[model samples]
Target: MIQGFVKTPEVQALLDRASGKTVEGGDDRLKAITRDLVESLMATIVKYDVTESEFWSSIKFFQDGAREFGLIVPGLGLEHFMDLYMDAKDKEAGQSGGTPRTIEGPLYVEGAPLVEGDVDLSDDPDETGTLYMTGQIKGPEGESPDGAILHVWHANSQGFYSHFDPTGAQTPFNNRRRIKIGSDGRYSFHSKMPNGYSVPPGGSTETLLKAIGRHGNRPAHVHFFVEAPGYRALTTQINFGDDPFAKDDFAFATREGLLPVPQRQGDSAYVAFDFELQRSASSDDEVFSARSRAAA
Candidate 1:
């Protein structure tokens, strides 16, 4: 017999393991998913005549990217891919007319201060240009829903998120908050216009981008998460109209309806945006609201 490293047996074994096509024959769902993936990957390897060295080098790149993998996911549009799949499923289920879901970037911090209407989020009093954000949560039937929890956060002017940005470590949970909806499903907050952030320099996330000749910059935006008893929780973001990169977002997260016209009110922006939630039809739909983080 040829060595274990020989190509034919190794390839067949890989396909069997990935497709779960052994005599054991277990887990139909997993096998179906893995079979497609392994088959496509094998086709690419064969068609491109990828060398062993090149394959392992790419694997090493991913291993290094794992250090800051969260930062890399959105850039690759994988996060948005999840949103697209969800949107398609919702459409198939006749679930329509809610705030379009967007990528929930990886910087959400659990347990921010829970407050009532209108709390200032600026860490510095001297922070300029306040943002007055107000919105109501409407149910799938288009009626206001009570007792919805809204979690919101964004980067500061310097393009860094607290707890994630090294320079922002001291400001853990800075500019982040959780607000409870009132009886009318109305919620509001006071904040400075959060600026956009760029991928960290010298990090694997940026290194991958640079290698591909792409700029890794996200436009200024605010993230929102909401969950109600009978409605699906929603996670979305809105981009500032004037951000240079707003229209050319590297992450492909923007939707036409998401950009709101900013009204100026004495060095502050007054934004009135509303969210509509879809009625949960299945446990999978309900999980959308409960799970924001990806699995390990």
Candidate 2:
């Protein structure tokens, strides 16, 4: 085994310089985080006695897979870990009792047209498998929240999202909408049934999954961003309970309270669910996080 030198003073000086700890006039938080991250990575390299080829190959993998990083992060469970971390933090702060949050999965498009009460989200005349989903937005006390906005999006029957579909067959916001809840707090939408999807074949995500003996598949699910004046903005989604991958999502997004079964109603399927929002403890909690999202 190679002699471990990561904890030596020589390596410590190198890490400090590389992480900007030896420099001035940089963001303190960034410098501190960089220092910790570089230190940990250096320790890992020493522990594993990683070869130069292995280190360069890992860098090349990241460089080549830059575009698929969104999918990769979720597939690797990093995104789900964020939700779990936040949930634990909330519990530690004595806050609890609301719909569970899951991974957003990096497909959300901002600026969907806003509608009041209800709207139809599917417009393709050739589309089949109609789905009608209705839900209410309620406060933690089971009271209807006034002026709640529900932003919803999902994949089409072909397992392709609107803006992200490579076939160019879907119109802008084809299965996306922003609903302003009425006085009754009820929001509903009609759309084609969403189908589960796997990661792109022969792509970076699939390549990594193959190496790790995992499948890059997600279940049929609907994404939502619900917010009200006095309530914390919630980012959650529900997976169809009957889907084969629902219980084994590669994204680790499925949660106990988020599996909603669909009922057959005539030629269409119906899903009834409710979102319970926690009261916002701060103004920041009332708005969605400033994450980068596609706008169209």
Q: Relative to the true structure, how large is the alpha-carbon lDDT of every model?
A: 0.78, 0.90
Q: Candidate 1, which segments miss by more than 4 Å at Cα? A: 1-13, 23-26, 124-127, 265-267, 282-284, 287-296
Best by lDDT: 2
Candidate 2 pairs with clashing backbones: none
Q: Each model's RMSD to truth, in Å?
A: 4.0, 1.3
> Candidate 1 on 1-296: residue-level lDDT in tens?
22332247768787777677774858888887887787777777777778999999989999877867777888888988999998898789787888899988787887788888777776654355878888788886768776688888888767777776675443666688888887788887887667777888898988999999999888888888888777777889888776788888878778888888678777778888988888876656544444455321
Which parts of model 2 have CA positions greater than 4 angstroms off? 2-4, 265-267
Q: In candidate 1, how many Å is residue 128 off?
A: 3.6
Task: Give each model a TM-score.
Answer: 0.87, 0.97
Please state the error at residue 175 of candidate 2 in Å: 0.3
For residues 1-296, write the lDDT of model 2, one tens digit per residue.
Answer: 54568878898899889988887888989999999999889888888989999999999998999999999999998999999999999999999999998888889999998987569887664356888998888998889988899999999988999999989899998889999898888888988888899999998999999999999888989999998998999999999998899999999999999999889766568899999999999999999878778998
